[model samples]
Target chain A: MTMRSPLSRVRGLGSAHSGTEHFLTQRMTAIANVPLVLFFVYLLVTLAGRSHAAVSATLSNSTTAIFLLAAILSVVIHMRIGMQIIIEDYVHHDGLKMSLMMANTFFSIAIGLCAGFAILKLNFGL
Target chain B: MAEIRTRNPRPLSPHLQVYRLTMTMAMSILHRITGAALYFGTILFVWWLFAAATSRGFEALNSFFDTWFGQLMLFGYSWALIHHMLGGIRHLVWDTGRGLGPAEREFSAWATMVGSISLTVMVWILGLTLRG
Candidate 1:
């Protein structure tokens, strides 16, 4: 006889033991963001009020493009996971929670891709 | 949950509403709020990047950003970002198990608040000076 209830068995409630992934990823991205984001801030502040050509020239640099892409990717991942945790905490309706989580994931990916594409465009002058 | 046919209205656990705000609790909530704000702020950042890449919308975007309303929004976004970053640093410190004491936690919260404000102001000052 199984100790699990019928619903538990049906729902496949066994622990995958990978629960630490979310917590760890959040922290990893957080650590990465500290430096990347600071660099991002510095870039923006230095580039403030500059002409479009100047901004373009700065971004076209290989090293600058690389760091910008890394910042966007890391920041978006961190943003997505953080919003999911917020949704889980405050949203009580299961259906709404699932939908919001899906939207959260999609939104993060969309913005990240947009930012990445732009950076590449500048990098290649395309 | 599967076996219970009748649901009982049992006592619910006390939530945030029941607790008074302390520096620690306030900081935690502020961290979440700032983080949430940053999520939207990032959208604007993406748009800025897109404008820069295309090289078409930069002038219009710059004009808009020079407006008072835009400056206000930018200020708020910068503060939220700075505060959230400081909060993350505090969490990193606490993760090492060295800042769990009552005094340490509270002090860290206060430090994050002050440091974020100071940094944000300094950044804006630097930005304005550079522009000039």
Candidate 2:
């Protein structure tokens, strides 16, 4: 039992000063993924053995495009956060860990943008 | 800071060799492995998307994915996705301050393993039948 200011105790801030945000966000994405992934699996099953035009037409549907975009965004964010935690745990070197964390963020963003753009282009028949 | 040079080096506690493996421990490690697998496996998704959007390379990509090796990779990727998904659900249950008991934890671990395989098989079967 150490003495601490009431405000500080009430804040309950961790070293990063943002308590529980990362944990909650991760869970939020997981919850979102449940239905999204189910839909994705169903989509895949429907697309199997179909012609390129047929598959493209299915994905070009507005609803399909929207769901794909949301899933891609959620997945990329979730992946980045998950990888960041792993890197932080395993990488003891400060410099290398920082660099890896940055790379992870950029990689996730790149994947998200590329996938999202592809979906939008298909949806618009571009 | 200088003390680092003179510090004693010791084997860390809870080393894998010394500890008897348990279902929960194995599942925990598998969850991480599968998560990493999915991380790399996502490139396939991007490739498919790019191919679909361009409408030029899709036929070649599709044929490649139909090969024996491609089917094997797809099978592995599907299993990884489902397993990781069930593992995520288990984690979410734990986050709610529930399922921490020994029996519940073990059951969840087994359920994740079994459910993923079952789902993957069922999905593949459906895909195969519908293709006919």
Candidate 3:
């Protein structure tokens, strides 16, 4: 076997794709999370202890329904993105990391769909 | 195969014990732990939404959350939510490169603690007032 030079051994190891994308995505999610969280906080504060009928009526309202839907969807997406980095950085097995990331994404999408459907079904009086 | 060396000559960096712990350190750890907690807590929101959307009435979801254990979980979640939000604001300030100095970092950490507690108290008071 041909021996490789030390220079060739370390040629591709610079900051060339170094953790920058992950850092940027984390920041992006942080920004997205802010308003979504605020919306959720407001919703919880307003809805606390309301009767079932009143709560249902509020959820049926277009404005509240849409805001809740948007907030929940954003939260799911944000959580998925945040956890992906945590897993990628910590989980050593490449196959496990990929599988876990895929699971996280799918789970978020499923949750988002269910949340959105729930809000819309109530909105249409179904 | 070549025999493996018993030990490396190069020194390794010390772990967590090497540094003194402070409020900032506590806050930093809390931020990540709270993040993970919130990740799980978020599923509850999804469940709530789905229950509200699909069920004929709110009883299903309401009763589940109205239970003692559920209420406890909710309270913990509320605390975590407020704590993490304050931490996020602190992180944003740090992101802007404004609070990395020692004194300012300490102030930010304390602010996170105080703000989260204050918000939690305010929400609980509001909940009780409305309940009454």
Candidate 4:
């Protein structure tokens, strides 16, 4: 077997590879976002002009609740993946890039969690 | 006699004209632009949500979103959101190292643009249909 270049093997290790990983994740998330987004659009269109109670009632439906949760989760993950790539590419400060990536992950998670909880609470009337 | 000679070698890799542009490339660029737009656009969503949650009757929110300018903003935001999502998928396929050739790349690009626009138009049509 022909030997690979040292750079070829090492190029993707650690920080360098993280960018590629992020890119892959971005694409993965995009594929995931497709169905989730379509469902979300349908959900939103249905929710248009709905009363608060009616909206809550719809969310309370197990199917609706699940759909909403899935949509939010996929979207938040997708956003995090996209932003991570942007930061890795543009941010030169090593410390700042790491810090911002961590912060972005946390924020996206929090938003997803809160949004999920809100939907659940509304649906369950708890 | 003193003479100076200089050999300007041809430029390095990635000559723009040599490689035909692909749909994947176009989509890749759109993905970035849409992502950036969505990043900023989230602020609008935050503002609208805050207005609805904190203020009375949703009038403040309604007034803002119901205005011509508000509709335009919303339209732009929706387009960005949809476009970015489609472009992101195109990127994902590229990342897998499967769709880099000329034909597939162009196909994905046109698909992203056409898909995004079609979805936008469909949604708008649905909105109009619902209203009537």
Candidate 5:
């Protein structure tokens, strides 16, 4: 049986099991982002500013659309954990640290959705 | 609560100020710094995508990026992104229990620094050529 404690409110005295989850997810996203980020560079550098129809049509391609969306998701998550680790390391003030952590969460999600929404809009035109 | 303001000053790990600056240490800090830079850069990226998706104001956005200032920022951002990526790769290599030696760390530090810059320069060169 897993040794996780049954007590719900264990005060300030226990290991936070979620740290491993955070660490592993950070690495996982980092691994995924390498290729995704490369594709993203290619997408913007080559195809971004062509004609409107060309851009839209490119996005509509299944492979391009999927990879772009995957890149968006992977990158946003990577950046979030990356920033959170930074804040945890350098920002020692309690309130400020908590606020920045929350802000990082909100910022990552907002941008992820914004990027994903944009890609979907381009792909679907709806 | 962080309890950072407790009356008794707490003992701490010796920090950057104490250590002689080494290639590995510099790369370690640069990794964090570039990571922070890329956070802001991601905002610019998301904005670019949103603009392109909406099909409105896209030209103005792209044109801004075409300007000198935007070009400088993009140059900085791309370099930061690439450097961070290489740094992460080095970390991954170290995570595998290889390349953890002091000399190996220095080698990887040099590799990350040079590799990121070279890649950024090459990519931008090709990108600008394609644009032309």
Candidate 6:
């Protein structure tokens, strides 16, 4: 009942087997981002013109911390996947593309960790 | 695998330069550009978080963000974020197997551009007014 080519089936491959997962996760993150990003903008507006202590205090709230962390995680993953697609399409060189893909993943992870750690530290008043 | 070589230069597919510009095409490119911009812009978010966490150098960072140049950069970043966001929504709509008609596609493109700018302006206005 499969539509895949016989050769593809024999090779146990099907058009970049992970494409659907990538596409779905991208969309899922996009949906999650809609509300989370709105909340983020609201946080920014609330923080505007405030003192450092005031800003930190606002971020220290558990709800605020949770939302911020979630947004950061989703945004980073979504960004990495998006960039990977662009790199795949435009970078034809196998070596260069693989390097860039690795860099992109590492960069996203680094950003996520740094941002998440900062949020947690602030939340704990450390 | 046997080594293979082409006697002639490989035929390359037509790229951006080969096509005439259109609104949808431009917006599609801009969506990717703005998405990339947001990737870089996340550094600003991280800086803010780090400043908040350390409770040191926060004022200096705040002052820098308050300056005209910093404000301009923030404005650009906000616009890019908003634009990419609306572009994402447009993409989601397309994913649902809807809005693929040529007219709907063009309308969505225009809406994404205008809506992002308007939303950014509204947020900025609210921020300024609330500060007063």
How many clashes does each candidate structure show, in the order listed?
0, 0, 1, 3, 0, 0
| DockQ scores for all predicted structures | 0.54, 0.41, 0.41, 0.14, 0.43, 0.49
Task: Identify the runs in model 3 with alpha carbons over 4 angstroms from their true place.
Answer: A1-22, B1-13, B17-20, B56-60, B130-132
Model 4: residues >4 Å from true position, as ranges?
Answer: A1-28, A48-54, B1-26, B39-59, B95-99
Find the 10 residues in a row with the least total lDDT in model 6 chain A: A8-17
TM-score of each: 0.89, 0.89, 0.82, 0.71, 0.87, 0.91
Model 3 collision count = 1
Model 6, A1-126: lDDT tens digits are 899886765563344577889989999999999999888887877686579878988899999999999999899989999999899878877789889999999999999999999999988766
Superposed model 1: Cα runs more than 4 Å off: A1-16, B1-6, B130-132
C-alpha positional error of residue B6 in candidate 2 after TM-score superposition, expressed in Å: 6.3
lDDT of 5 by residue, B1-132 (tens): 314366889899887898899899899999999988888887888777777778788788777777888778777877887898899999888879999988888889999999999998898888868878
Strongest candidate by TM-score: 6
Estimate how well candidate 4 is docked, as a DockQ score: 0.14
Global fold similarity of model 4 (TM-score): 0.71
**Two-way DockQ contest, 1 vs 2, winner:** 1
Give stretches of model 2 more than 4 Å off. Answer: A1-14, B1-6
Q: Under CAPRI classification, how is model 2 graded?
A: acceptable
Which regions of candidate 5 fall more than 4 Å away from where they truly are? A1-14, A48-54, B1-6, B130-132
Model 3 TM: 0.82
Cα lDDT tens digits for candidate 6, B77-126:
87887899899999988888999999999999999988999999999899
RMSD of candidate 5 to the truth, in angstroms, is 4.6
TM-score-wise, the better of 4 and 6 is 6
lDDT of 3 by residue, A1-126 (tens): 759996776666554565687567667767776777776776676675567667777789888877777677667766787788678657866688889989888877887787787788888865
Q: Model 2, A1-126: lDDT tens per residue?
A: 869876776553434555388888999999999898888887876775578989999999999999999999889988988998899778877789889999998889999999998998998766
lDDT of 1 by residue, A32-81 (tens): 99889888877877776678988889889999999988988899989998
Worst 10 residues of 6 chain B by lDDT: B1-10
lDDT of 3 at B76: 78
Put the candidates in lDDT order, highest first.
6, 1, 2, 5, 3, 4
Model 4 chain B: weakest 10-residue lDDT segment is B46-55
